[model samples]
Structures are given as structure tokens and as C-alpha cells.
Target: MSHSAEHGRVRAGYNAVAEDYQKQIGGELAHKAVDRALLGVVVEAARGGLVADLGCGPGHVAGWLAKQGASVVGIDLSPGMVEIARREHPAAEFREGDLLRLPAADGEFAAAVALYSVIHLEPGELRPAFAEMRRVLRPSGTLLVSFHLGTEVRRLDEWWGHPVAIDFHFLESERVAALLAEAGFTVEARLEREGLPEEAATRRGYLLARRDAG
Candidate 1:
């Protein structure tokens, strides 16, 4: 499917479950110490500059970043998701945008976190999405990405008892590193951990990359 079409489906799916998602998954950091540690590293790397929390659903991650002293904005494809994020994170900014074509100026951000946000993109579209992210990041900007680790696509027909359409694509860590490299980033670190029982029962991958200063 085209990226636009996929984004539409993803938007609809998230809109259908925005409230439940926030209630169930918003405070997930409380349970995942590993994720919190990784996020701390990401925030420190940003060096107190603007950061983009792409696919920031309900602004949980953005709120965390704010507490860590980084100026952050939350962006998601679903208007409903953005609305909830605004309501929940009254101090932060939330905008509706697509990952393939972010609504921001080039080199507009110093760091970005796409935590499980790109899982909805088809494998072939990953590179372009990463390129868009890189384009919006300043030199030496840090990027931290998290996603399911595997080689398969899982489609959800319903979420929170609401009917919807979306696909979650799992990818290998090595493959993701290669794609980041292809998008003009240098992979700086890679972390993998077994999923919590609350999350999907699969391994997860986290990669930290940086834009070359030169």
C-alpha cells in the first residue's frame, strides 16, 4: 500500500483507541526500566535542544522528555491522538503530521525519538521516513528508535474493542541499522531486550544513531 494510505489506516486505528491506549500504555515507562534508561541517554545526547517525539501518542514520552529538561514536541498522524496529547500534556506542543513528510523546517530539531512509531510503515518505506527525520535534524543530532525485533507483519483488526485496520511490521535489528545508515546516519549503539509480559511477547530492538556533523 502507498504510504499515504497506510498512514490513513494507522490514523484511523489509533483514533479508534486513543483513550484506551493512553490509559493502558501511557504510563508504560513505569514498568520498563530499560526503556527509561535508554530514553535518559537520548535526552542527555540532545544537549538541551529541541527534540521531536515522532508518533508521540498522548504525549507520554514528550512529557518525560520535558521533565528531563529538553524542549520537546509531540507529533502523531491522528488528530484525535494529537488532541489527547495536548490535553494530557498541557505544557507541551502537539501537532498532526506524517512521518514520511514531517511538517517542519529542515534542521529544525536537535534530536528525535520514534519509539515504536515506524512499526506501521512498510519495510520499503523505512528509509524515506528516516531520511525525512534526518532532514529535520540539526548536525550531530541524536536519534533513538525502538521497535519489535523479528521478520513479520501483524495486522490488528480491532483495538480496545473498536474496529480498525493497521499493520505492525517487525524487522531485524541488523536490517534497521543498515536502513539508518542508508538514510545518512551513523549507528552509534544497539540494544535488545525481551519484552515485558504487558507488551507483545517478542524481542525488542533499540538503535541510537547520529547525524554526521561534517
Candidate 2:
């Protein structure tokens, strides 16, 4: 399928369960110490500059950053998610956007975060998505991305009693790091951890990268 078609499916799927998804995982940060620490690093690196929370669902991450005094904007492909994010987290701005084609101007963000979001992209699409992120970030900007660690694609046809279609692509840390390098980012740190009891039964990977200054 075309990228647009895939994105449409993902969007529709998220829109169908936006409310329930939020209720299920909205306060997830409270349970994720590592995630909060990594996000804190992003906020500190931002230095009061604008931070883009790409694929932000329900604005929880963005909201957490906002509470940390970072200027944040949450972007998602689902209008339903955006609406809920805006209502639930008034501290941060929320908008509908795509990772392959962000809504901001070039060099618009000091930092970017994509937690458990890029798993929606196919393997061939990862580099382009990271490149678009690099395009929107200033030189030396920080980026933190998290995803399931493996090599598999899991599809879901129903979520929270809603009929939908979506695929979650598990990725390898090394492969994602290499793609980040090709997309003008230098991997700074990498972490892998087993999923917590509350999360899916899979390993997780987190990579911190900096946009190459040169």
C-alpha cells in the first residue's frame, strides 16, 4: 500500500479509539521513570526553546514537558487525538500533522520527541521520517525516540471495542541508529529495557540523537 493509504488507516484507527486510548495510557509517565528522565534531558537541552512532540497522543508527554517549563507543541495525525490532547492538556499546543511532512518551518524546534510513535512507519519510511525531523530541528538539536525492540509487525483490527486497522512495527536499535545517522543525526545514547508489567510483553528501545552541527 502507498504511504498515504497506510497513514490513513493508522489515523482512522487512532481516531476510533482516541478517547479510550487516552484514558488507558494518559497518565503513563507516572509509571515510567526512565521515560520521564529521558524527557527531562530533552527539556533541559531545549533551553526554553520550542520543543516538538511528534506523534503526540493525548498530549501527555507534551504536557509533562510544559510542566517542566519547556515551550511545547504536540503534533499528531489524528484530528480526534489532537482535539482530546488540546482539551486534556491546555498547557501545550496541539495540532494535526504527519511525521513525513511536519507543519512547522525549517529549523523550528530545539528538540523533538517521538515516543512509541514511529512504530507505525514501515521500515523503508524510517529514514524519511527522521530526515523530516532533522529538517525541522536546529543544528545540534536533541531528539529522543522510543519503540518496541524487535523485528516484527503486529496488526490490530479492533481496539477498545472500536473497529479499526493499524500496524505496529517493532524495530531494532542498531538499524534505527544507522538510519538516524543517514538522516543527519548523530546517535548520542542508546538504552534497551524489558517492558514493564503495564506495557506490552516486549522489549523496548530508546535512542537519543543530536542533529549534526556541520
**Which has the greatest TM-score?**
2
Return the clash pairs for model 1, or none.
none
Q: lDDT scores for all predictions?
A: 0.91, 0.96
Model 1 residue runs over 4 Å out of place are none
- Model 1 reaches what TM-score against the true structure? 0.97
Candidate 2, 95-205: lDDT as tens digits: 899999999999999999999899999888999999999999999999999999999899999898999989999999999999999999999999999999998899999
Q: What is the lDDT of residue 77 in candidate 1?
A: 92
In TM-score terms, candidate 2 sits at: 0.99
Cα lDDT tens digits, model 1, 1-214, are: 6778888999999999999999999999889998889889888888888899999998999988888888898899999889999998876788899999898889989999999999999888899999999999998899999999998999999888999999999989999999999899999999999999888798999999998775
User: What's model 1's lDDT at 62?
Assistant: 94
- Candidate topping lDDT: 2
* Per-structure clash totals for the candidates: 0, 0
On the 0 to 100 scale, the lDDT of residue 150 in model 1 is: 90
